[model samples]
Target: MKFAPERSSVALFVALTRAVREAPVAEGGRSLAYDVIDRLAKVINTPGFKVELEALIALGAREPVLNSALEPFWQELHMLSSSSSAGSA
Candidate 1:
């Protein structure tokens, strides 16, 4: 079944988060979560990526479960974006 953008976004986020968390450690004993989050923070600052990220966050805000689940990452992205823009200013 085809899902709406918001629904798909939520699902994708959930899946990625779970997969990253479950991924076996290579050598550092660290999960992919940190790397993923760091990359995501940078991606969110790009024009197209920023738009997509904002769309997902806006939809998440209206969906209770996703909103809460995505809160920390969303907040971090926003903080990073703000700092990045400020630095460029």
Candidate 2:
């Protein structure tokens, strides 16, 4: 698989964060934030998930509602990311 360069990654992250703001709720009825959280939960197992996760966490930290909504998912992904990194190291 091809990895995104850091610049592209950041751009993609920014775009996603913005696009998600007005994202429609999924057909199953979960909020858009929850939908993105669920997708993140999956992608985070793949290579190079760190950059995007970090950007989202940083963005979330600066916004009250996003911070609250994203914190749990961020923590979950962070724990997984930490453990994986430790294992590789």
Candidate 3:
């Protein structure tokens, strides 16, 4: 399996923060759900990224702020999981 370039946890945090912050759920702006799912969709197909994303979600859920940020993406994550599993079968 091919490995992606190593990224620090801090870098991942910063990227997610930027993504979430840029997506304002207000008039004239896209919803948080759309932005979060879009961010995950871009990486979900990359080798090892899905697993890391799941783990990150689990860890993030322990924190209230992170959990709120992640809430909108849960349904999209489930759909991605189902489609990927079917594709692999």
Candidate 4:
């Protein structure tokens, strides 16, 4: 099934989060860990997964396979919550 752009973005964000979280902390890899953490923080605070996607793209993610591999739960939540908020407003 095809997903909206926002949904695709969020799925990618969640996949990235899981990958980072599952990655083993290597010895003498504090810098790498910190970088990953920073990226995670930025992604989490981003208004939408598109921003996270753009960031990934800027980081040289050009392969269709790689892009397709990332999930889009971020976009899903953004849409769901935003719609709920709008309804409440």
Ten contiguous residues minimizing lDDT sum, candidate 1:
25-34
Tens digit per residue, CA lDDT, model 4, 1-89: 87555444456455565644444433333334335435644545344434543554433244333333333333553454455445554
Best by lDDT: 3
- For model 4, state the Cα shift of residue 37 in Å: 7.4
Better of 2 and 3 by lDDT: 3
Winner of 2 and 3 under TM-score: 3
**Can you write out model 3's per-residue Cα lDDT over 23-67, one digit (the tens) per residue?**
433422324434444555565545444665666575455444555
Local accuracy of candidate 1 as per-residue lDDT tens digits, 1-89: 55333333345456547644554434232233444444554464454455545655654555445455555456545654565556555
Worst 10 residues of 3 by lDDT: 24-33
The residue ranges of model 3 lying beyond 4 angstroms of the native Cα positions read: 1-50
RMSD of 3: 12.1
* TM value for model 1: 0.41
Off by over 4 Å in 1: 1-16, 19-45, 83-89
Please give each candidate's TM-score: 0.41, 0.43, 0.45, 0.31
Query: What is each predicted model's overall lDDT from 0 to 1?
Result: 0.49, 0.51, 0.52, 0.44
Per-residue accuracy of model 2 over 1-89 as CA lDDT, tens digit each = 56333343345445445545544434332244445544555565454456556655665555556665444345445765675456555
Q: Write down the worst ten-residue block by lDDT for model 4.
A: 60-69
